[model samples]
Target: MRTIAALELADCRRIAAAAEAMAAQHQASVSLAICDGGGHPLLVVRLDGASPSSTAVAMAKARMAALNGKPTADQEAAINGPRPALLQLAGVFKEGAVAMGGGLPLLHSDTCIGGVGISGMTPELDGAIAAAAAAALQGQPG
Candidate 1:
């Protein structure tokens, strides 16, 4: 069997902290989620005053990025563009796979090792925060 890199607890904490810092910088309440490459959740944080729905959306976005190996917004565009039908299929094919923005895959050695998702803000801002979290993992071993 081939070995797959995974995020450690420390890495998860770092990603969460980075995302939280970004949220604070913007004075936004948000929810963040991190998942392994297999789309299994590793960590989730719902900041104070964030909407309750954000937690679920955050996890869905993380799963979408982790499994698809791309940002959730890109996936959303693809599905809504050439393959509009895929949007319907997403429900049955990929449970908890959202097409919205704010999800970023974490890479190690150019390979996707995990993903981070942020919610409770505009899609652009959420994506930015997730990107920041992913960047924190840059140059780090899996």
Candidate 2:
């Protein structure tokens, strides 16, 4: 078996911080979540005024990104493409996976180490927050 890099507490902190900053910049009340490569949650934050449901949505987005190694928006596009029926059938096998625009995989050395998810605002803003968090991971050691 081969070993893979994993996210540490510091990494989680950085992701949360960046996501929070993004939310603040956008004036959005949002929820952010981070998950391990295996799709296990590591950290979750709900900004002031964010709805309770945002937390669950954030977690699901993070899991989708980590497990699929791609942005949730891309997954959304795939699921809505011409062959959507086939994609939906496949999605049935990947329970809890969602097609949304607020999740991004955390990459280290071109390998997915974790993921970040954001919710509460529009899908565009949520995706921006998640992207900021994922970008913050760059240049940091795994």
Candidate 3:
């Protein structure tokens, strides 16, 4: 059997803190979510002033990224470009892959470990925060 690294609880806390710091930097209120390799939730934070609906949306985005092992924005672009038919398949997946610009996959040594997602602010800000969270994972010392 092969061995791979997985995110620990401390890693999740670091990711959440990174995401929150990025959101605060932009004065944006958003929902942040982190998930395990299997798309299981690890941490979720809904900042003050964020929309109530953002919680579930953020979770779905995180799960989508974790399951797909890629950024959710890629799917968004594909569906918006020349694969609109993909929209019909969203409900078919266990984790609803939202075609948005705020979800990022967590990869370590080329192995996907989990995902980070942010919502409630503009897509730009959400994406920024998610990216920050992913960076935190990368910055972790092995």
Candidate 4:
């Protein structure tokens, strides 16, 4: 059998903190989510001034990143571009893969271990936060 790394609580906390820091730096209010390899939530936070709907959207983006091992922006591009048909597949997911920016997978040794997602402000700001959070995983133990 092969062994794969998984995210621990500390990793989740670290990612969330990084996301929050990025948002704070930008003076953006957003919701953040961290999830395990299986798309299970580890931590979720909705910052002040964020829309309540953003909380659910953040979680959905995180789940999609974790399960797909891809950034949600790519998914968004696909649906918005030549592959609008992809939306049909999204409908069947337990939480539809949020086809938007602001989600990234946590990779260790090139393998996805989890994901981080952010939402509320502009997609650019949210994606920046998610990128910062995913970067926090660098140098962390498996």
Candidate 5:
């Protein structure tokens, strides 16, 4: 028999709590999103004062990270300027998958099993909050 894994409810909730805590510590309202390994959103939260549009952006960021299994920072260099090919890689860009800061891959035992996206602040701030949450999950027991 074949087996596959999916993001658990507890995992989603943990991520949301951690992300919200980090963003609040930074004094930034944020839109947080969690997606499964397939880049489909499992959970989303927009803190008070977060822009409504930030929700979509957060989802896109999570999708990008889940699909790529790499930090969105790496994609930033490729998406700049007129000759960028970022839009042609897997038909994701057209759907608003932003390959920039604020998105990070979530891992378990060195396996990238999901991703988190954060928005509603400066790109740097967004990235910082996301990184904080992602980093906090490191070395956590399953």
Candidate 6:
């Protein structure tokens, strides 16, 4: 049976707010996306000047990490292996998953309960912003 575990509106807002704050500090527009534990999108936000392409890129990268229950950096690092299908089918390369940084998995306890992705900036900055957003929602109620 399929289960649903989407993020609440309040949580989504909190994540976006964190991302916006970081983006403002960096003087960069960004696309942010949050996905549930199951890698389904719960919310997506794109700043006005953010690149249109970053929206999809952010979501895909976040979902990839969330689905695997690991940081996207690790996933990308292991992309090339005996089975190319995982990376190929995932379209991970196109999503910028293998880049040095940009995607991070969100966690609750030891389980990865979600992921936050930010794009439209340097990969380091993207990862930083996403991490900041997740940190913001760390102790709050859903």
Predicted structure 3: lDDT: 0.85
Q: How high is each candidate's TM-score? A: 0.90, 0.89, 0.92, 0.92, 0.85, 0.79
Q: What C-alpha lDDT do the candidate models reach, one value each?
A: 0.87, 0.85, 0.85, 0.86, 0.81, 0.75
By TM-score: ranked, best first: 4, 3, 1, 2, 5, 6
lDDT of 1 by residue, 1-142 (tens): 7777789999999989888888899998999999999889999999999999999999988988888788988878887789777576357635787889999988887789988989999999998899888878873322
Model 5 TM-score is: 0.85
Clashing pairs in 2: none
Say which candidate scores most in lDDT: 1
Q: What digit string (tens of lDDT, one per residue) describes model 3 on residues 13-111?
A: 989988888888899989998988888888988999999899888988888888878788887898899988767645767565586889989999999
Give lDDT for model 5: 0.81
lDDT of 1 at 127: 89
lDDT of 4 by residue, 109-134 (tens): 99998888899988888898999899
lDDT of 5 by residue, 95-139 (tens): 657887899998876677888999889889888888876765663
Candidate 6 lDDT, tens digit per residue, 1-142?
A: 7454456879878888888888888898889988887777888889989999999888877877677667666555665544445566366334434322466777766667788888788877888888788887786422
TM-score of 2: 0.89
Candidate 1, position 98, lDDT: 86
- Which model, 3 or 6, shows the larger lDDT? 3
Local lDDT at 12 for model 2 = 94
Better of 2 and 6 by TM-score: 2
Of candidates 6 and 5, the better by lDDT:
5
